[model samples]
Target: MHYVESPTSPLYSSISNTSFSSSPSGTFYFDDDEGEKSDEEEEEPDEEEKNQSLEEVDVSVLKTFLNDKLHQLGEKPQMEYPELDLIPRCRFRPSDYILIVHYVINKVLNYPLPCDWVEDAEELYNHNPELIAGSS
Candidate 1:
């Protein structure tokens, strides 16, 4: 036995003929009247505009935020690893270590390091012979 749907069936009557249409490519799409912007039509900020916005941000605000984050990091309890104690004692203080990290990060980012930081980093390097061997 085979079941056939007639044009007069309730299912056929409920669906509007205008709801879908076929394109020249033989692909069917819903006919929508609401205007919507496509991805291509949307405007994005240009490099100049992005740079201007970045320039507008206060340096002090960024500094304060960095200081707060660093303070929080310092407040965290230091974890002790017994195996790491086999190495010679590091001469760098916590602040000096932070300075060294900042120096390295600045170098990696290709940003200019401040004169004082360079001097401090040199001093720390001179004081620590172990770092030289590890670096090599």
Candidate 2:
């Protein structure tokens, strides 16, 4: 019997230039279900697999690279800035968040920045969810 995949099945990612989607292995298949219904009988792709075609990246490797880079910059950078405690603390790296808040956002707002970098907080948290999740 041919391999068939149904929606709602957990799709373990395949390797080789892995993609969030659009890779050669972007293909997702279901277990062979002879009784499975047709697409006409099924829900749309949005019905939910939660994570389909999740690219297989080694998080440990990514974490190691980040750690080494941070080491190069030294503990001074981390120590000088404040922890972003006003925000409830998601998975974002303290060092990375400080770099952006202390440098990038500070410059963007044209200095005279108050103790709070509140203006850019939402933007940072929203955009970096994936990276934060991966790092965690």
Candidate 3:
């Protein structure tokens, strides 16, 4: 199946707006909005905070905002997703799900997370004092 990406797809931005771009290995953005921001852009506000209030709201609020706008414009929101094979998927172990979920929730809430949560979790899980076996 062909995955058509339109510039105006709000869900593409809304759901994609979640922390999907942040990967343990590298950046992976499904939509253009998540792309690299130059220094000038970094100096600017996050896409959500640009025209909206600086108070970080849940990403679900973005969905609601899009819904209100579309309804007022008399347009129905549609999301045409690429096939599972076509989309890039990240595989995480069961042990990894907790950290991943917490991290995503923090992102949705616009809370700050460590630069690399996976690396941090790994360092803790693999090299913590409990596992050091008698070394002070």
Candidate 4:
């Protein structure tokens, strides 16, 4: 089989100016134009252009998409962990879910997490005592 990568593919630039061919023996060979460089290899974006591209991404869209995907995973089943009872399970509460989403968004955007972001459920309960009385 012979395969030609499309120029529009994200991986095209990395494997450009090359073609792949497989023989009946299942051996693959890469035919590369060693003397020539693809157009993509010649052009590089400046720092300002990279920043502009990042700025163009809509954070709200990313949040919504991530939330939807998380929800699709379904609620986690409750289980006892006697040895690890001191740990807080963030998957049990709606607010915890939001916190998780925000944490992920902040990570993706290279933003620092809030000082109050708690990983331990016990610590979270101590910070927001009222949460302990509420049922999941």
Compare the candidates by lDDT and give the number of the best one: 4
Error of 1 at 133 (Å): 17
lDDT of 3 at 114: 60
List lDDT for all candidates, in order.
0.43, 0.40, 0.42, 0.49
Q: After superposing candidate 1, which stretches have Cα over 4 Å from the reference?
A: 1-43, 50-60, 72-89, 93-101, 104-109, 112-136
TM-score, one value per model: 0.29, 0.22, 0.21, 0.35
lDDT of 4 by residue, 3-98 (tens): 233588433453444464333333334555666666785546556544453334466655665465445546552243344434454433334345
lDDT of 4: 0.49
Q: In model 4, where is the ten-residue run with the lowest total lDDT?
A: 20-29
Model 1, span 1-136: residue lDDT tens:
2223358843334333325333333333454543555668645656654444333444444344345444544544234434444445554333423542465335544568765323235555345555554554
C-alpha lDDT of candidate 3 relative to the true structure: 0.42
Which candidate model has the greater lDDT, 1 or 3?
A: 1
**What is candidate 1's TM-score against the reference?**
0.29
lDDT of model 3 at residue 111? 72
- Per-prediction count of colliding residue pairs? 0, 1, 0, 1
Candidate 2 lDDT score at position 9: 26
Over 4 Å off in model 3, which ranges? 8-57, 76-136
TM-score of 3: 0.21
